[model samples]
Target: MTRTPETPLPSLKERRRLREAQSLSQADVAAAVGVTRATVRSWENGRTTPRGTTRDAYARLLTGAEEVTPHQENPAPALVGAATGPVQTSPDRAEPTPEPPSETSPASELAPTLEPALGPEPEPGPDAELEPLSPSLTPDQAFDALYAFCAPALVRQTYLLTGRRELARESVERAFQLAWHRWPEVAMDRDPAGWVRATAYEFALSPWHRLRPRHRNPEPPPAAPADRALLDVLLQLPPVYRRTLLLYDGVGLNLPETAAETEASTPAAANRLLHAREAVATRLPELAEPKELHRRLAEVASAERLRPAKPTTVRWGGEQRARHWTRAAIAFTVVLIGATTLTLRTAPDHYEPPLAPGATVHGVPPRVAPGPLSAEELALRAKLKGEIASGPERLVPEAG
Candidate 1:
C-alpha cells in the first residue's frame, strides 16, 4: 500500500470535489482514514501529498468504498464517483457543496462545504482479517545481530590496542556485556560495531589492568616475524600514538572515524597518525611506504579473531534496565547511610555547663527582639531633633 515517492498523487482539486460530493466532513474522513483532520485538509489544499496506506484509505473513503481496505503490497486506485467533475449544490442547502476549483479560486479559499452524507463508520466484522502489527525485535535477536557482525573485528581491534591477546579478549567481552546492557541505544546508532570497538579500545587502556601481573607475560609469538616486530614497536609508542595507528591503519577506519574513536580532532588525529607511521617506519625501514605500513599493521592486527560464547538469551528491553536501576538505588542509599554514620562519628563532641538563672550561653545567641537605642545614640538623636525644630533661625544665629 506504500506508494513510491515518485508517483504523482491524486490532485487536491479532484479530492476536494469528491469529498464534497460524498458530503463528508474532514473530521469524519480523518477518523475513517486514521489520520488527523489537518492531514485531510493538507491533502485538499495541495499543501502536502499523502503516501502509503493513509493515502489509499483516504481515496477509498471519499469514493464510498469504505469496506475495501488497502492492500498490504500494492494498491489499485480508488474510483471517485461524481466527484471527478463539477459538484452540483442546491441553494436551500444549509451547507452547499463546493464546485471544482478553477484558475480563479485561491488555495486559501478551499474549505469543506458539505453535510455528512455517510453515516457513522461501520464496526469491524467478526470474519475480517485486520492488518497484522509488525513484531518488535527481541533483545536476544538484536544482540545476536550486532554480536555476530562486530565481535571478531572488535576483538582484533582491542588486541591491536593492547599488545596482549588475553587482555584483548577480556576487554572485548566486557564491552559486549555493556553493549547488551544498553542494546536499545547501541542498536539505534549508525555504527554499532564502531561503538563496540571504541568501548573495547578504552577498556584495554583501563588502569585496573596494571594490578594483574599475569597480563605482563608476552602472548604467543606472532606467526610472522614481521608482525612480531611490528607489535613490539607499537607497544613502545605512547598510548595515543599507538591507538591512532591501530584505528587508522590496523582497523582500517577513515581519518575522521579514527579521530572520533581516539577523542581527538580530525587534524590532530591525522597529525598523530602521520607521526605514528613515521615512528614505525623509523624502527622498520621496509614499512616506510604508507600502504605497506598499513598492510603490515593490518596483517599483525588480524592475527586473532575473538568469538565469545553466545548468551542463551539476552534479556532485552526493560527488565535488565530495571534491575540495574534498582541496584544503583540500593547502593546510593547504602552510601548515604554510611556517610551519615561516618560524619556523626567524626564530628566534634563538646560538653556544655548548665546556664545560670540570668546568664546566656554564647553558643546559642540571644533571640530577643531589638529594643531602645544606646545612651550615646539617644543623645545624638535629641540634638538632631532640636536643630531640625529651630531650622534656618537657629542656623543664622549660630553663624553670627
Candidate 2:
C-alpha cells in the first residue's frame, strides 16, 4: 500500500514574522504590486489570502518552501502536523519527508534563502491590471508624420534662416524628439503643432548648437539661401520676440493665446508682435509685398495642414480669439485712462470768477471798482462814446 506524507502549516504570526525576517516590509511588497500595505498585512495575518494576481505573487514569494506547496493540496494535514507534532510519513510514499522543525522552521529558512531570488512583483488588488506599454514610433515614422503636417513651413523657416536643407532637417528632428517626450503635455496645448515647430527652432538655436565651431567661424557670409533665411532671422531675434512672432504668424495663435503660451502679459505679447513684425519687414523686404508673402506663407501653412487632423480637435479657437479681443480692449481702455490722467495732471489752472454782468473797462470784461460808476467813469464813458460816435455814423444810433 502506498502512503502519503503530510505537510506542515505555519500560523499567521509565523508568516508575518517570516516576512519581517527577510527585511521585506509590508509596504515594500505592497508597492511592488500596486497595493496598500494594509492588504499585505492582511495576507500575513491569515485574515485573507491575496486574491487573483496578489495571490500569485504570494505563491511566487514562497516558491522555495516545501511546506507551503504541500499545504496547498491538503490544508488539514499540514495544519495538524504544524499544530501537534512532527509529521510522520510512510516509507512507501514517493514524496520526501519534511525534516523535523529546527529552532528555525522551514518557513523561516525559506524566507532568508528566497529573499535574494525574489524580486518585487506586481501586487494584486481590485486595481491591479497590467498596463500596456506606450506605443513606440521610430524616428523616421515620427519625421514622416510631422513633416507631412508642418514640414513645408518648417522647411521654409529653416531655409529662411540656415539656407541649408540639412540644417533645417536637423533642427526639426530635434524639436520632434522633444515633442515626443512631452507628447501628453504638448498634445493638450492649444497649438500643439505650432508649438512643435517653435520648439524645433528653439532647439536649433540652443547653446549646444551655438557652441559648434562652424557657427563661430567668420567666413564670408554665404548667400542667403531662400529656405534658410527665415530661420536665420528667427534665430537672430531675441527669444521673446521670436516666440511672439512664431505664435502669432507661424502658429496662427492670436495674441492672448500666445501670451498664455509664452507666459507674457497680453500687452507685452502685443508689443513683441509689433516689434517682431517691424524687424521681419526690415530684414525681409520681400514680405512687404503682401501678395507674394501671403502666397509663400500659405504654401507653408498648407503643408502643416497635412499633419494628423486629430491634434487640432482641441477647439481653443473661439475662446482664445475672444480672450485676445478682450485683452486688446482692456489695454486700449487703460491707455485712454492713463492719457486722460496725465493731461489732467499737467494742465494749467485757468478758471477765474465770471465778470459781473454789464461791467466794462476799455471794451474788456471789467473788474469791480472800489465804488460804483462815478463821474470819472461817466467822463471816460462819454469820451469812449464820443470816439464811437465819430466813427461810424454815431455808432448807428445805438441800435436800440
Candidate 3:
C-alpha cells in the first residue's frame, strides 16, 4: 500500500520566500513539476490550493536542504542551495538571477531584469500572528485595518487603469464592499489587499463603462506633443501590456509580485513589459529609456495622491440588514391592511350604522291610501256627475 504523504510543511508564503531565496525562476520549477507556472502560482496565492502529488512536489521544492545563513557584518542574508540539485532553466533564456550585491555595489543600484520565481508567495492573513497588541481582533477590526492601509493605493492604481477619477472611486468602493461581506475569508488570505485590488480591477472593466458618458473631452485643445504621444500610446497598448507596465513600474512591484497580480508567469510578464516599453519607446523616443518611462509613470501615479481621500462607502452587512427590516415592515403592513378590509366586509357589527332617537331604520318606506276630498270639492263632483248624465240630448238641442 502506498503510504499517505505528510501535509505540506510550509505555508504558501513560506514557499515563495524559499523560491526567492533560491533565486530560481518560476519556469524552472514549472519544468521540474511538469506543470505550468500559473498552476504553481495558484497554489501559492490560495486561488486554488495544491493537493496530493502537487502538494508533495511543492513541499519538496520549497523545503529542500538549502539554507541561507545570516551574517552580522553583512545585513543581507545569503542564499544557499545544493550546487548539484535540480534547477530549471530554459536554453534560450537570456536573463539569469543576479548575485546579491553589497551595500555599496554598483550592481545594487540597477534594477535587474529578473523573471519571477515559479511558485506563488503567500501574504500574511489577518489572523496570522501580527506584531504586538491584542491576541485576537474581530473580523471587522481586521477588515478596517486592511481597508485603511490599502484603499488609497487601490484608488490610485484603479484610476491609472480606468483614467476616470469617479469611475475609479466607484470601483474601489464596490470592491471594498465585497471584501466587507466576505470578511472572514478575506481576513484569512495571505494578501487581503491583493483580493481587493483584483476585485477593483474587474469592476473597472465592467460593462457599465460603456453606459457612462465620457467625462473628459476626447480631443483636448493644445497639449505638449510628448504628453499627447505618451497618453495615446499608453492607452493604445493592449490591456495586458498596459496593466503589466503600470503594475511593474508605476506601482513599484517586483517581477514576482506583478506576476501574481496579473495571474501570468514571470516570463510572460517580462515579455509584456518589454513589448510595452518598446511600443512606447518607438512612439516617443524622448521617453524611451527605462528611467524616463518609470519617471513619467511615477509622475502620473503621484498626481492622484493629491486628490482628497474617500472613505470606503460600502457596508454590505448593514445595508442588507436595513433591507431585511424594510421588507418585513412592508409585509406586516400589507397583512394588517388585508385583515382590516376582511373584517369590515364580513362582520355585521363592523358594517352596521348607529340607531337615531325614536327612529327605526327600514329597508323600504310604507305606502299610504288616498285621503277624503274637502266639502267644496264634493259639491263640484256631484254637479259634474248630473250634467254628464243629461249632457248628450241637452247639448244637441242647443246646437240645433
* Candidate 1 steric clashes: 0
Candidate 3 residue lDDT tens string, 320-340: 755888999999999999999
TM-scores of the candidates in the order shown = 0.48, 0.32, 0.51
Q: How does candidate 3 score on lDDT?
A: 0.59
Candidates, ranked, lDDT: 1, 3, 2
Clashing pairs in 3: 13-122, 26-117, 26-118, 123-190
lDDT of 1 by residue, 264-362 (tens): 755577568668877888999998655566566556655555454454432333356568889999999999999999999998789787768987557
Q: Write the per-residue lDDT of candidate 2 for residues 1-400, one digit (tens) a residue.
A: 8964333335676766665555555555565544544445445645445545445555445443322211111101111122123434333221113334455332212111101111112111211222222348653354345445564455445433443445556676556555655656655443455577667666655667557777665333234364245445655778678666654554334343455557665556657865766676688887643234434444432332222222222123324555788999999999999999999999987978877888864755766768678898899998886664455766576654
RMSD (Cα, Å) for all candidates, in order, is 25.4, 27.4, 13.6
| Location of the lowest summed lDDT over 10 successive residues in candidate 3 | 74-83
For residue 63, what is the lDDT in candidate 2?
Answer: 43
Candidate 2 segments whose C-alpha is farther than 4 A from its true place = 1-147, 159-165, 182-191, 218-236, 282-286, 289-400
Question: Which is superior by lDDT, 1 or 2?
Answer: 1
| Model 3, total clashes | 4
lDDT (0 to 1) per candidate: 0.61, 0.48, 0.59
Models sorted by TM-score, best on top: 3, 1, 2
Tell how far residue 247 is off in model 3, in angstroms. 1.2
